[model samples]
Target chain A: MKYVDEFRDPVLAKSLIKQINILVEQIDFAKERPIQLMEFCGGHTHTIFRYGIEQLLPKCIELVHGPGCPVCVLPMGRVDDCVSLAERPEVIFTTFGDAMRVPGSKKSLLQAKADGADVRMVYSPLDALQLAHKYKDREVIFFALGFETTMPSTALTVLQAEADGLENFSLFCNHITTVPTIKAILDSPGMQLDGFVAPGHVSMVVGEQPFHFVCEKYKKPIVITGFEPLDILQSIWLLIKQIAEKRCIVENQYARVVQPDGNFPGLDAISRVFELREFFEWRGLGSIDHSGVRMKDDYARFDAERKFPVPNVRIADPKSCQCGEVLKGVIKPWQCKVFGSQCTPETPMGALMVSSEGACAAYYNFGNLPELMALKAEREKEEALS
Target chain B: MTASVPGMRKRSGVLRAETINMSHGGGGKAMRDLIEDVFIGAFDNNELSMLEDQARIELSTLTALGDRLALTTDSYVVDPIFFNGGDIGKLAVCGTVNDLAVGGAVPLYLTCGMIIEEGLSVADLRIIVASMKAAADAAGVKIVTGDTKVVDRGAADKVFINTAGVGVISKAHKISAHNAKPGDVVLINGYIGDHGAAIVGARGDLAIENDIQSDCQPLNKLIQSLLQACPNVHCMRDATRGGVGSVLNEFAVSSGVCFKLRETSIPVRTEVRGMCEILGLDPLYLANEGKVVVVLPKADAEAALAAMKSNQYGVNSAIIGEVTDAPTDTVILQTSFGGERIVDMLVGDQLPRIC
Candidate 1:
C-alpha cells in the first residue's frame, strides 16, 4: 500500500483543506452561484464519492462529475448490437464486468447470457484472446470500450494477436477519446465551468499536448490529477491558485504517473491500430465528430464489427431523462425528472444511472446524507415561509 | 481401509474409481455404499448410525432448553472448494450454525444435502465430509440426516452443499434486526474481509500472491457467552455474503434508524484492504465466514465487548459504529479522511471493475 496509502493520508488532506479554505476566502465570492470545477474523469468522480471529498470542500467550490465512464456513455443501440453479436451461434462475446449490466434496446448482456448467449466477463483483452485460442471453432469477440488510458492496451493486444497469427480473435471497438468529448461539453450552452481536473491515466498516454487547446482557447486552468484523496485536494489547490492569479495553463498534478510528453511507444501502438471515425454516438450527448476510434483499415481482419453482421441501429434516450443536462452541469442528478422515479440503478433508463462512475449512480449510492438532509430541511423551510 | 476402532460400524471397500460415476447417486447399493462410507463413516454419531430417513428427537429435551425453535437453512457454492484455511464443507456448517446462533439459539441438529458433479473425485468427497464432521463437532451439533445426488459432468462445478439446522431460542433472548434503537452501539467480531480477500486471491483470477487465509469458524459458543454476559443485546447478524455494509443497511431499513460507522474503528487487515483497492472494490461488501455484527445499548456495550474480546473469534472485536435517529433507513460511513458518505446496499453482484 506504499503508493496508495501515501496519497490517502488524512494529515496531508486536512492540511490541503485548510489551504483551500484560506484560498477560497481570498477570492471574490458570489453568494448565489458557486464556482464550478469539473473533474473530467469517471474515476475521479468515483473517488470523490467514495471518500466523500465533496463534503469536506468549502461551500463555494462545487465539483461537477464529468462524462468519463466509457460504460456510462455507451449508447443503447451499440449495446443491442453487442448483444446481437453475442447471440450468434458460434460467437463468444467478452467484455469488462462494468459493461455487462448496461441496457441494450431489448436487454443487457447479462440478460442475453441468461437467454443462452455466450457472454463472459473478462478483465483484459488478452483473456478474450485466450478464449479464442481455447475454443478454435468458436468466434471470440471482445467488446472494447474505454478512453485513451485503456486504448493502448487494446492496441497492444491486437498487435500481440498479429504477432502470434491468431485468426479467431477480434475486437468490437467502441473506444472514445476524452479530449473532444470534454470540448463538446465545454462548448455546450449550460453552466460555465471555471477549471478542470483532467483525467490522469488518459494524459499518461496522450500527454498534456491535447489539453493545451482548453487552456489557450477556453482560458480554463486544467490540472492533470490523480484519484487519491490528497491528490485531488492538491489538484484543487493548484486550480484555485491559478484562478486567483488569473492564469490558465495545462499543469500536471499527477506528475508521479503522467509525463508532459506521454509514453511514445504507447501512442505509436495506438496510432498504428486505431483511426478516428467520422462520428460516434454517445448515450447522453448525441453524436460527436471524431470522438471515437475504430481499427485501421489494415487491421480490419481483427475487427469484430466487420467480421460479424449486426443491426447497428440508433435508439433515442428517453424524453423525460435529463442525462444531457446532468452531463453539462446544468442540473443536479436529483433535479432530473426521472432520477429516482424511472431511472434507478436497478432498472436504469439513462446511462448515468447504470454505472457506479456515473454521477447519478454515485449520488444515489453514496451521496452525503447530512448535506441531503440539510437541503431537505432548507426546502421545507422555504416552502413554509412562502 | 480398516476401521479406526474396535466394534465400529463395518467399512466399505476402498473406492473403485478415482472419480465418481452416475451409479453413486442411482439410489442403489453403490449410492448406499457411498453415503455409508463417505458421510456416515465420518459423521459417526448414534443419531446418524441408525440409518433412518429422519432423525427422532425427544420433545422434552427441545422444550427444556428454550420456548421457541429457530429453524434456518443455507446453501454453499464457494469456488476453489479447498482454500488456505477451510473448504466448502466447513463453510456450509459454519454458515448454518452462525445463522441460528445470531438468533440466540442453541443449535441442536443439522440435515445435510449435497449435489455433486459426476466426475468429482471420491476421495475429495470424503475429505469434504470429513471437514463438515469436524466443523459440526466443534459447534456441538450433530449431522443427523443427509441425501446426495450426482449430476452430469458439466452440470455442477464440483459439489454444492445445503444444510438445514434446528435450534432452540430462549424466550428472554428477544433478538432481531429491527430491535436496534437509537443510542445502540454497533460492534464487530474480529477483522473483516479475511474470508473474502482469501477467496478472491485463492480464485487465482488476479494471479496475486497473498498469504491471507479464510476466517471460517462457528460462532455459537462465542455468541452464547456474550448473551451470558449481557442478555439485552438488541440484534446480532453474521456478515456473510454481503458483509457488514449490507447487514447494517438491513438493520437501518428494518428499524427505521441510521448507522454511523467510523472507518478508523472498523477492523480490516492492511493486506485485505490492499486487495480490495487493487480490484476497485470496497471491503465493506466483501463476504466473511467468521464475522458477527452486534448492536446493543450503551450500558451493555462495555460488558458485551469485554465478553466478545475474551472469546477466540472476538479477540479483534471493536465498536465500529452507533445507531442514530436521523436519516432513517440509511447507513453512513465516516471515512478515515474525516468525511462522511452514505453506505447503501450493493446492487447486482459486486464485480471487479477493469479500469
Candidate 2:
C-alpha cells in the first residue's frame, strides 16, 4: 500500500485536474473540437474508467482507449492453436487467467478445459516451468502473451528452463512489441489523435528511447504514463501543456519507475531468446510488421509452435464488430453496432469484448449503460441526418 | 438407554482403516464404524446417537422458539479444503447457519451430507469432522443427521459437503429483501474479501505469501442481537459467494431501489486490498464467508450499529451506504476519488489480468 495509496490520493488528483483544466483553456483547439488524447495501454484505460477520471476531466478533452491490451488484440487463430495444443493428451497448456476466456474458432480455453483438456492458469511462466519439472511425462506449454513489459520475464523463464535442461518445457509465444503497433496507429488514415499517453510498464522495460519516434518523426507529444489515477491526470496535463506550447517531445511522467535508457538485462534476455516475426496478425488491426516475436533458432526447443502440431488457421473478426475503428479511436465503443446487443462480456463476439482490458468490454462493464445508450442514440441520429 | 448403564450394550464402533475406501460407504459394518467413530464421536448428541434414518424434531419444541420455520441449504466445494483460519467443515456449518440467520431465524439444526473421494486419509477426515463439530457448538446448533458416500479416486475432489439447516423465525420479525425502502442505511459487519483472499493465497497458484486468514464464522449471535435492537430490519443477507456487491445488487433489484455506497466507508483490509491490486481484482466482487449486509431505516441506524458493535462478530461494523429512490435496480459507488461508477453484478468469475 505504500506505493499504491500515494498515487490514489484524491487531493493530488484534484490539483492535477485543476492544472489540466487551465492548460485546456489556453489551447485554441478546444474551442473548435475536443482535444482527443489516447492512452495506449489497457492498464491506463482501466485506471481511467476505474477512477472515473474521464467524468472528472473538463469536457474539452476526450480520452480514447487504445488497443494496448495484449489479450484483447490476440487473433482467434492463435487461440485455436492454443486450444488444440491443450487438448493434446501429452501436453499441459498454461496461460494467464484472462486469456482462458478468449474465444477460439471452436471454443475458448475455458470450454476446452470443461471438455477435458489439461489447461491450467498460472501467475508466471516460472510456475509453468515448475509444472514441467513436476510432471516430466507431460509437456508444459506456457502461453506467452503481453508486450515488452512481460517479454523479459518470459525470456528469463525460457533461459532458466534451458539452463535446467528442461526438455518438456516450451512457449506458445504471442509476445508483441509496443513501438511497431504505436507506429501502425500513427500511420492510420483519418487518425486525429492530438497526443499519446504511452504505457508505463512497457516504458519501464524498453524505456523512453523507443517512443522518441512519436515526437521526433510524427511530431506528436507522448508521455510515458503510469497506471494510477494521479499518474494519468498528471500525464494528461503534460500532454496538454506540450500542445498548448506547440512543443512535441517524449516525456516520462512515471519517471520513478521508467528510466530513460530502459532495463538492460531484460532487453538482453529478450534479444537472446526471441526475434521479430515477419508479420503478425492482430484481432482488430491485421498484419503489423515486426509487431510480434518468436523464439530464436537457438531456443527452438523451447518454442511450442515448432515442437508441437498446431492448427494455425486464420479466422477473421465478426462483420458486425467495429473494433478496428474503436482501436484507431475513429469511433467510441458504444458507437459500434454489436457493442451492447450481440457482443457483451458474457458472450463476446469480438476480441475487444472478450478481455476486461479491451476497450469495448471496459466501456460495457464500467460505463453507465443508460448514459451510453442515450449517447449511442444521439450519435445515430446525427449520422442519419448527415 | 444410556451407554454408561451396567446392562447396556456398547453402541460405539471402532474404525481400524487408515484411509477411506469404497467399503466405508457400503452400508455395512465398515460404514457403521465410520459413522460411530468419526462423526458421532465429534458431534455427540442424544438425537444423533439414536442412529435413526432421519432426524425427528418435536413440533412443540420448534414452536417454543418461533412461529415460522426457515429452511436453507448450501454445498461447499472449495479447493484446498484446509485453509488459513478455517476448513471446509467450518465453512459448511457457518454457511448454512448464516443463511437461516439472515432471514431473522434462530438457527437450531443442520443436516450434513458428504461425498468423498476414495483414498482420502482417515486422519484428515477426523480433522474436518472435528472442525464442523466445533463450529456447530459455537453456533449453538446440533448436527442431528447426516449421510456419506465414497466415489472412485478420480470421480471427485478430496471431499464435498452439503448442509441443509432449519431455524425458527419469530412472529415479531419479518425480514425480506423486498422490504427495503428509500432512505434505509446499509451496514456490514466487518472487512470484506478476507475469505476470498485467503483461499487464493492458499491455492499456491499465485505463490503470493501473506498472513491473510479466512473470516469464516457464524453470524447467528450477531444477527440475533441486531434483530433485538432493531426489530424492523428490512433486508439482510450473508455476503458469501459474490461478496457485498452482489448482495447489494440483489437488494436493489428486489426492492426496485438504488444503493449508493461510499467507497471510503466500506471496510476492506489493507492486505486484501493489496492482493486485489496485484491481481486486477476488485475487492467489491470478492467472496466473504462471515460478512453480512444489513438494511434498515435511518432512524434506527444508530441502534443497529451499536448493537452490531457490541457483538464479537460485528466489532468492525459500519454504515456503508443508503438506499435511494431514483435509478431503480442499480448499485452505485461514490468512489474515494470523487467519482461515481455503477457496481453491476459480475458476468462470470473475475479473472486475473495478464499485466
Candidate 3:
C-alpha cells in the first residue's frame, strides 16, 4: 500500500488535472478537433476506466485504448491450438484467468474445460510447474500469454523447470514484443496524428529505447507512463507540453518503477529462452512479421507446441467485426455495424469484445451508459410501434 | 458451545472410525449413529430430536406468522472449508437465511443436507456441524431436518452443504428488485470484499495473504431492524457470489432504472482494498457474505440508515448511492476522482489485466 496509495492520491490528481487543462488550452491546435493520445497498454486502459481518468481530463484530449492486452491481440488460431493441446487425455492445461475467455475458432478454454478437459487457471507459470511436480504421471503445459511484462517470469519459470529436471512441464509460448505491434499501429493508414503514452510495465523490461522510433522518426511525443490516476494525468500534461513546444521525445513519467536502460537480467533471461517467430498471428490485426516470440532451440524440450503436437490451424477474423479499425484508431467502437446490436460481452463475435481490455469491449461495456439507456428505450419504442 | 448432550439419549452404538468410509452413508446403523452423534447431538431441538423421516409442523403456525411463505435454497462448495472468519457450515446456514430475509420474511426453519467425501476426518466433520448449530441459534431459526452421504475419496471435495429454508412474509411487507424508483437511496451494510479477499488470500498460493477475514454472518436480525424502521424499503439483497456489482445490475435491469454510486461512500477496509489492488480485482465485484444492498425512498432513507446503524451487522452501514430514472438498465459509479463509468458485469470471472 505504501507505493500504491501515493500514486492514487486524489489531491495530487486534482493538481495534475488542472495543470493538464492549462497545457491543453495552450496546445489547442485549430480548436476544430481534439488532441489524440494513445496509451499502448491495456493496464493503462483499465486504470483510465477504473479511476475515470478520461472523464477527469479536458475534452480536447482523447485516450485511445491500444493493442496492449495480449488476450485481445491473440488470434483464434492460437486459442484453438491451445484447446487442441488441452483436449488431450494425458495433458493438463494451465493459463491465466484472463485468457480463459478468449474465443477460439471452435471454443474458448473455458468451453473446453466444461467439455471435460483438464484445463485449469493458474496465477503464475510457477503454479503450473507445481502441478507438474504434484502429478508426476501427467504432462503439464502452461499457456504463456502476454507481452514483455510477463516474458521475464515465464522465461525464469522455464529455467527453473530445466534446473529441477522437470521434463513433464512445457510452455505454449504466445509472448509478444511491443515494438513491432507499436510500429504496425503507426504504419497503419489514416490514423489521426498525436502523441502516445507508452506501456509502463513493458518499458520496465525492454527499457525506453524500444519506443524511441515513435518520437525520432514519427515525430510524436511518447511518454512511458505508469498506470495510476495521478500518473496518467501527469503523463497527459507532459505530452501536452511537448506538443505545444514542438518537441518529440520519449519521457519517463513513471521513473520510480521503470528505468531508461530497463531491467538487464530480465531481458537477458527472455532472450535466453525465446526466439522471434517468422510470423505470429494477432486477433484484430492480421499476422505481423517478427511480432511474436517462441521458445528458443535450446529450450525446445520445454515447448508445449512441439511436445504436444497440436493441430495448429489458421483461422481468419470474422468479416463483420471492425476490430482492426478500432485497434488502429481508424474508427470508434460505436461506429461499427455490429457493436452492441449484434456483438456483446456475453456473446462476443470479435476478439475485441472477448476481453474487457480491448477497445471495442471497453467502449461497449463502460462507454455512454446514460446515452445507452436512451438508446435502449428508443429501440423498445420502435419494437412496440412495429 | 459447551458440548454436553443432556437432552438427546445417546445411541449406544457409536462407531469407531477416525475417518469416514463408504459404509457410513449405507443407511444402516452406522449412518444413524453418525447423524445422532454429530448433528442431532449438536442441534438437540425437539423437532430434530424426534429423528423422523420428515419434519411435521402445523399449517396454522405458518398462517399465524404471515399470509405467504418464502422458501429459498442455496448450495455451498467454498474451497478451504475453514477460513479465517467462518467455515462452510456457517456459510450454508447464513446463505439460506439471508436469501429468505431479503424477501421481507422472518426465517423460521431450515433443512441441511451434506455430501461428504470419504476419508474426511471425523473430528473436522464434528467441528463443522457444531458451527452450523451455533449459526442457526444466532439467526433464531431451527435446523429441523437433514441428510448426509459419503462418496469415494476423489468423487467429492472434503464436504459440500445444501440448505433449504422457509420463512413467512407478512401481507404488508412488499420487497422486490422492481420496486425501486427514482430518487431512492442505496445503502450497504459494513465493508465489502471481506469474504472474497479472505478466500483468495486464504488459498496461500498467491503469497499476497494478509489478516483479512470473511464477513460471513446471518442477516435476519439486521433485516428485522430495517423493516421495523422503514417498512417501505424498496429492495433488499445480500451481495453474495458476484458481490455488490451483480446484485446492483440485477436491480437496474429489473426495475428499468439506473444507479449513480459514490465510490468513496462504499465502505471497504484498507487491507481488503490493498489485496484487491494486488490481485487486480475490483472490490465492488468481490464477494461478501455479511453485506446486503438496501434501497429505500428518500423520505425513509434516514430512518433506515439509523436502524441499520443500531444493529450489530450494519454498524458500518452508510448511504452509498442514489437511483436515477434516465440511465435505465445501467449502473454507473461516481469514481473517487469525480468521474463516472459504467460498472458492467465481467464476461467471466474477474481476471487481471496484463500491463
Candidate 4:
C-alpha cells in the first residue's frame, strides 16, 4: 500500500478537483458545451469508476471510456476459434481468467471447459509454457491477447520457448497495436473528443514518440496517464490546463514508470517475434488497418494458428449492440438500447458488457443500477411512442 | 455375539493402505478401518463412540438450552485442501459452526461427510480428520456422525468436506435480517479478506509472495459474548464467500434500508489490500472465513463493540458504518477518496483483470 496509498490521498484529490474546477471555468468553450476527455485504456476507466472520480469531477468535464480493454474488443469469431482450439483432446488451452467468459458464436471457453475440455486460467504466458514442459505429450496453446502493455511479456515468453526448444508450446497470438486504433478513432465521423488520456502501461512499452501524431496531426492534447485515482485526476487537470491555454501537446503524467523513449528491450522482443497484420477485426469496431499483430513467418512453428486447424471465420456483431458509439464517446453506455434490458454482466450481449474494464460493465457494476434502469425504462417508453 | 455383551472382545479395525482406493468406500473392512482409525480416533466423544447409525441426545438436554433448534450445513471444496491458517477439515467444522452462531444459536453438534479422490494419501486424510476434531473441540461442539466416499482419480478433487451443524437458539433472542431499522449501526469483528488473500497466495498461480494467513476460526464464542451484551441484535451474518459486501447487500434488501459504509473504518490488512490492488480485485468482495457483519440499534452499538472486542476473535472489531433511511434497499460506500459509489451484489465470480 505504500505506492498505492500515496496516490489515493483524499486531501490531494480534493485540491486537484479544485484546480480542475478552476481550469474548466477559464476555458471559454466550456460555457457552450462540456469538454469531453477520453481515457483510452480500460484500466483508467476502471480507476475512474472504482474511486468514484467521475462523480467528483465538475459537470463541465466529461470522461469517455475508450476501447482499450483487450478482452472487450475481442471479436466473437476469435473467441470461437479459441473455443475450438480448447475443445481438441490433444491440446490444453490456457488464457487469462477474464477471457474465459467472453461468449463465442457457439460457446465460451468456460462452457467448453465445463463440457470436459482441458481449459486452464493462467496469469502469464510463461505459465502456459510451464504446462507445456510438464505435460510434454500434449500441445499447450496460450491465448496470447492484449495490447502492447502485454505484448512484450508474451514475446519474451516466445523467445524463452524457442531458446529452450520447447516443441509442445505455441501461441494463439492476438496482440494488438495501440496507435492505429487511436488513429481509427480520430478518423471516426462525428468525433468530438477534446483531449486524450493515453494508457500508461502501453506507453511504457512503446514510448511517447508513437503518440505525437495525436498532437501533430489531430491537434489534441494527450497525456500518458497512470491507473491510480490521483494519477487520473491529475491527468484530467493537465488536460484542462492545456485546453485553457489553447495548447496541444503530448505529456507524461506517469513519469515515474513510463520512460520518454520507452523500454528498449521489451520493444526489441516484440519486434523480434511479431509483425503487424494488414487488418484485424475489433469486436464492436469493424476491421482497422494494421491494428493487430501475428507471429512472424520465422516463428511459424510456434504459432498455434499455423500448427493447428483454426476455423478462421469472421462472425458479425449482434444486431442490437451499440458498442461502437459507446467506444467513440458518441453516447453513454446506459443510452445503448440493450444496456440493462438485454445485456448485463451475467449475460452480456455486447463486447462492452463483457469485461469489467469495459465501459458498460464498469457502469453496471459501480453506477446506481436503479437510476440506470429507470432511465432505460423512460427511453423505452419514448421510443415506443415516437 | 454382540460387542455390548460382557467379556466380549471389541473388534477394533486397522488400516494398512497408504492411499485411499475404492475399497475404502465399499462398506467393507477397509472402510470400517478408515472410519475407526481416522475419524473416531480423533473425534472421541461419547455420542460418536456409541457407533450407532444415529447420534442420540437426551430430550431434556435439548429442552434445557433453548426453545427452538437451529440446523445448518456447508460444503468445503477449496482447491488447496491445506492453507496457512487452516485446512478443509477445520474450514468444514468452523463454517457450519459460524452459520449456526450467526443465527444467535448455541452451537452443539456437527456431522461431517467427506468425498475423497482415489489417490489421496492416507496420511493426508489422518491430518485432515485431526484438524476437524481440533476445531470442533475448540468450539465445544461434538462431531456426532459422519460418512465418507471415494471416487476415481479424475472424478473429484483431492478431498471435499461437508459439515451439518445443530444448535439451540435461546427464546430471548429475536435476531433476523428484517429487524434492522434506520438508526441501526453496522459492525465487523476484525480484519477481512485475509482468508481470501491466503487462498490466492496458496494457489501460487500469480506467484505473489505474502505473509497473509487465513482468518479461519470459529466465531461462536465471539457471537455468544456479543449477544449477551446486546440481546436485541437486529441482524447478523458471517461474511464468507462474498465477504462483507454481499452480506450488506442482503441486509439492505431484507431490511429495506440503506447501509452506508465508510471505507476508512473497514479493517483490511495492508498485504491483502496490496494483493487486491495488484490483481485488480476489490477487498470488499473478497471472502473471509471468520468475519461477521452485525447490525444493531445505535444505542447498543458501544456495548456491542465492547463485548466483541473482549472476545478472542474480535479484538480488532470496529463500527464500520450506519444505516440510512432513504435510498431504500441499497448499499453505498463513502470511499477513502472524497467520493461515493454503489456496492452492488456480484453477478458471478470476481475474475482477475488483464492489466
Ranking by DockQ: 1, 4, 2, 3
| CAPRI-style grade of the A/B interface in model 4 | medium
Q: What TM-score does chain A of each model score against the native chain A?
A: 0.96, 0.96, 0.95, 0.97
User: After aligning candidate 1 to the native by TM-score, how far in Å is the CA of A145 from where it should be?
Assistant: 0.6
lDDT of 2 by residue, B1-355 (tens): 5647854335567899999999999998899899999999899998899989999999999999889999999999999999999999999999999999999999999999999999999999999999999999999999999999999998999999999999999998989999889999999999999999999989977878878999999999999999999999999999998889999999999999999999999999999999998888999999999999999999999999999999999999999999999677778888898777778788788888887
How high is the DockQ of candidate 3?
0.58
The lDDT of each candidate is 0.91, 0.92, 0.88, 0.93
Off by over 4 Å in 2: A368-370, A373-386, B1-11
Q: Each model's DockQ?
A: 0.74, 0.63, 0.58, 0.69
**Model 4, span B50-91: residue lDDT tens:** 989999999789889999999998999998999889999999
Best by DockQ: 1
Give per-residue CA lDDT, model 3, range A130-197, as digits (tens). Answer: 99999999999999989999999999999999999998999999999899988888888887769899
Q: List TM-scores for all candidates, in order.
A: 0.96, 0.96, 0.96, 0.96
Worst 10 residues of 3 chain B by lDDT: B6-15
lDDT of 4 by residue, A57-160 (tens): 89888889999999999999999999989999999999999998898998999899999999999988989999999999999999999999999999999999
Looking at candidate 2, what is the lDDT of residue A353?
Answer: 87
What is the lDDT, from 0 to 100, of the residue A283 in candidate 1? 89
- Give interface RMSD for all predictions: 1.3, 1.8, 2.1, 1.9
The reply for model 3, stretches above 4 Å from the true place, is A28-30, A370-386, B1-13
